[model samples]
Target: MDDLNLGKKLQMYRTSRSMSIRELSDATGITASMLSQIEHEQVNPSINSLNNIAKALGVPLYCFFQEEIIKEPVVRHDSRKTIGRPENAEEVYYELLTPDTNGTIEFCMMVIPPHSNSFDSVHCHTGEEVAYFLGDGDHIGITIEGRTLHLKRDDSVRIAPFSNHVWHNDTDQTARVIFAITPPSF
Candidate 1:
């Protein structure tokens, strides 16, 4: 996300509500300077900070991310209609907004087109997981609790379910990585 661009969106929302930085600060208990930084996109906000602002602005926290999606009454982004995509293209399929589930955690879908590489070369997180999936030969490779649980299409496995686990599909076909991340890995 463009940090600088965020300021404009924040400013728009604030002004539309006829709320100044000081007013927002009083309402949200946030410093006006911090609010100004956020409005200018100079600072990336923490979850608590975002929630405070969302409350003050009378919007959902997810409104800041899915600008276009929030405009629709229903979630309309479809995966099947994604054009020019290969048989197993690596693409983010969906973004789930669950306020009841602490809202900080996010779940996104990734389709790894056959014989393709991950957009995240390698990454790390902080929790655990109970993992399972299926695909083609050597299709699923997940690092779970220090063990590399590998599975092929239709094969299933269980993991401890932690954020430290990593998933990779190094095959000629696409594999889906179903995830549950804490503290929201958006």
Candidate 2:
């Protein structure tokens, strides 16, 4: 990975969110001096530190590795960024419909396998999200703030910022959904 580019992207995201270095440090549990050094490209951040930074910035860890800003507007289907594979606790797969996390809104297509959950535990982020379920004759259950809601085909639900939520597929059929979030959180 190019340390200079990573540092620049980090600074850009942080400033876009109007977050100071100290605030980022507090959020990621990293030291302010270390964050500053990383931002300045004085030192390369470790994987753990990078993960914490990505979580604090509300962007995917891969966003830091994206080499350049997308000059083209369209993200081809074959080239769409995919994440959250078998290595993760949940086997849910996510394909980025948008080019990158540089924009105000982020869009993704999520595929949840049968009898699996979107997350291993309750997930909460700092942005408002809307999920639209797709596919015919299939459904999934979403639990938000301790209340479980069933969603069928073409159903859409809005989740408020920081509300704990999770998506679960109990049926034998795999579930697919399109998600849009402001200030992207992967």
Candidate 3:
């Protein structure tokens, strides 16, 4: 994410809703002091924290990083917007393949590190998603609802809305995957 503008956008969104930092903290389960730091750009927030904040604010997570709507048809790889939390143990990187989140579908590439998982707990979003595993060699594990599924190169899985799921890379090699989601939840 753009650290320079993240704080400004967050502050604008929070104040526009007439909600205080404490109120946002209560709604997002984040500490008020930490939220203040995030608003002031003193520290970077984890992906989970940002997701919670976005959900609580009723806004998409990409809004903080997206500067403007793209009028062009093509999005260059170098110009893609990215957001990640390096502080987390499972440091996954995501790059937007689409210009912005305003489109009907959100497309992005995820890079999962070796022996890493996407989140600390089960994750669920309002939008339905399809994740396609890319590259060769190692297989990735995805647990949706209560079933575990292994995906190899070229394998894909469709995730229903609000289904608890997590992505795992158990192999020593890094795994790459692409995700397409409707309604652009993340």
Candidate 4:
């Protein structure tokens, strides 16, 4: 399972959520030294412990194993739905697929300009999100997810939250996307 890489992933997600070791300690009741050790691969976290960290981070415990995550690019346009155009650097946009504010899942489209940031607010609630990005050469990172998900054209990712998540563009071009979430968040 590549303990070192998994530890790094866990650390990344934890820090991305703006969570400090002490804060995580408070939330998950783990120690700062232990969390630090886990990050450095000095100690292996048990599955139950990993699950606790995952729960505290608001992410699935299994996301640490996703490999072969490819990158994609953009070229054309189609109406899958949620065609929202948030002003930013990526020149990109997206559509939401569900009622995140009404039920359990909030769906929306995201259009990001290159080097743009995707977000509405540091909103919080129950459930999680899975974003299928359609922007090629667009760099998208959800802080709550820890690592950045770079897409080529059809890359997708799922995110849970331990803190407020922000989507950022790393490329200096336009990007587009579709975001879906469980549990309503308006």
Candidate 5:
């Protein structure tokens, strides 16, 4: 079952890059016919062949075994995957709004309950992040590098990479925010 799925994914990635089977075959040193068979799920490729293909496609070998491929660009609200809350923070929730692909940017929706914080401590990551407030009521509190900024509705803020940051919702209403991170450090 996994072999067939891998073949389909390979085909999708190759076609998405506008690369022909012959081109991939020449780049990977595999025969064109074998490449076609592998793409069609008619035959399974060895580990070495898969590694070569992955190199030619400019993707990691593990990409074939990751989550299901996104058939469309839009992510439905109910179908979004949750990244799970912090161990010490139950008042916050996170949902991944973008598909996990070979992209540098990742979108996530975060909900912070009233009068609560997202995490117990500030966290830092390698990639930059920008967060925008969604609702028209209340201001979301964001602390970055010891500076606190209160963001109003539709307001956005950028945070540098490696800066310690956390979010808080001090109002009586829930705070909703959509954040985009580059290089997907989360």
Candidate 6:
């Protein structure tokens, strides 16, 4: 994470979302002056403040720390960055396949271990998501808005925006999927 560049990235994301500083402040419950100071690199926001800002921006908290801005169009597999997850997150893992969020869509690779779930609770975000199962069989189950759908290899699903969704691997092998989200809300 580049501490000095955080403010610039914040400003970029805020402007890309068409949100004014005042609007962000109102949404995050932070003072407008403080937000301005953060954007100007005059102050360092605490983790709590950053979490609030991430929630307001509809992105993962790790998005702020990603330093690769994707100057070129290609993203190599070996160079792909992985988002940090909790230490206890042994069931699921995520690898960011997209080099940057400066585009309309973000891509990621999700791996769910056997008999494990992606999340403990169903979650929803601001943008639409499409998931493509890459496993060999219908071992992946995705629950969206209380309906569970079994997905096999080459199967894809388009999830509505803000729909509660969670995935699980019920088989004895790992389940893999390629997930894409519009507006880069991941």
lDDT of 1 by residue, 1-186 (tens): 352255677788899999888999999898999989978767656544665677689875545654332333343445222211233234423234232223445544445555543433334443332334635345677665556767766765544433345566667666765555555433
Pairs with backbone N, CA or C atoms under 3 Å apart (clashes), candidate 3: none
For candidate 2, lDDT tens digit of each residue in 1-186? 342277888999999999999999999999999999888877766545676789899887657755355768999988776654423534677778987777778898988878987776787878899999996337889999999999988999999999999989998887889999987765
- Model 4 alpha-carbon miss at residue 80, Å: 10
**Cα-based lDDT for every prediction:** 0.54, 0.80, 0.83, 0.59, 0.75, 0.78
Clash pairs detected, candidate 5: none
Arrange candidates by TM-score, highest first: which order? 3, 2, 6, 5, 1, 4
Candidate 2 residue pairs in backbone clash: none
Overall local distance difference test of candidate 3: 0.83
Residue 138's C-alpha lDDT in candidate 1? 58
Better of 2 and 5 by TM-score: 2
**Residue 111's C-alpha lDDT in candidate 2?**
83
Writing each residue's lDDT as its tens digit, candidate 6 over 71-147 gives: 66788987665543323345466677876666778898887777877776687777899999997546689999999
Candidate 3: segments with Cα more than 4 A from true spot = 86-90
Could you give me the TM-score of model 6 versus the true structure?
0.65
* TM values, all candidates: 0.42, 0.66, 0.86, 0.42, 0.60, 0.65
Q: Alpha carbon lDDT of residue 155, candidate 3?
A: 96
Off by over 4 Å in 5: 1-68, 85-90
Candidate 2: stretches off by over 4 Å? 1-67, 86-90
Better of 5 and 6 by TM-score: 6
Assess the local accuracy of residue 82 in candidate 4 as a C-alpha lDDT between 0 and 100: 25
Compared with the true structure, the alpha-carbon lDDT of candidate 4 equals 0.59
Error of 1 at 48 (Å): 25
